[model samples]
Target: MKISEIVTILDGVLVAGKDQMDREISFGFASDLMSDVLTLETNDLVLLTGLCNIQSIRTAEMSDIPCIIFVRRKKVTPEMIELAEESEITLIECNYSMFKTVVTLAEHGIRPLF
Candidate 1:
């Protein structure tokens, strides 16, 4: 499914890259560790992190993650939103816990190993 489709599946808010919503997302990596992300296989990356801070967004950018989904209803700052906008990364906010979010996506055909 595409990022746009996932947004609908999860009832998430698109905070950035509205135009890129149609971009297909084959897989996602759910984590809060930036270093691990940097070292992992993350080409077609959709980041799911509970760290509701600018660093999360920055880490996504550094790892070339096309999407960032903030789990656990954590709200990101306006600055992070703007950064995501500038980076052209799709950002979504959802109230689901990280485990629930990951499981839900996996059950819906989005696997981390893709």
Candidate 2:
């Protein structure tokens, strides 16, 4: 699914990488643990998490995750946004909890990493 579709589905705000909104994403993984995110091996992955920190952006960069959705209305810092922009990662913010974010994505045809 396209990032635009995901934004619509999750009612998210595109906080960075607006140009990447048309990018296609095939799989999604939800986790707050950076260790778990580091173990993921997939292409075109969208990471859904509540960890709104520079570390999250770094983990996504290291894992080659193209997009990240910050759930539960987490505050994404300017440092995080700057890092994401530099890393070419798309950042989105949503009011839904992580569970709801995952469920909404699944219901909209976004598959899990497994």
lDDT of 2 by residue, 2-102 (tens): 99999998999999888888999989999999999998879588999998889999998998899999999998889998999998899999999999999
Clashing pairs in 1: none
How would you encode candidate 1's per-residue C-alpha lDDT over 1-114 as one tens digit per residue? 899888887889887889898888888888888887778665686888888888888888877789999999988788998999998888899989999889889888897753
What TM-score would candidate 2 get against the native? 0.97
Per-prediction TM-score to the true structure, in the order listed: 0.94, 0.97
Which 10-residue window in model 2 sums to the lowest lDDT? 36-45
Candidate with the greatest lDDT versus the true structure: 2
- What's the CA error at residue 46 for candidate 2, in Å? 0.7
Report the CA-based lDDT of candidate 2 relative to the real structure: 0.91
Instruction: Sum up the clashes in candidate 2.
Output: 0
The per-residue C-alpha lDDT of model 1 at residue 106 equals 89
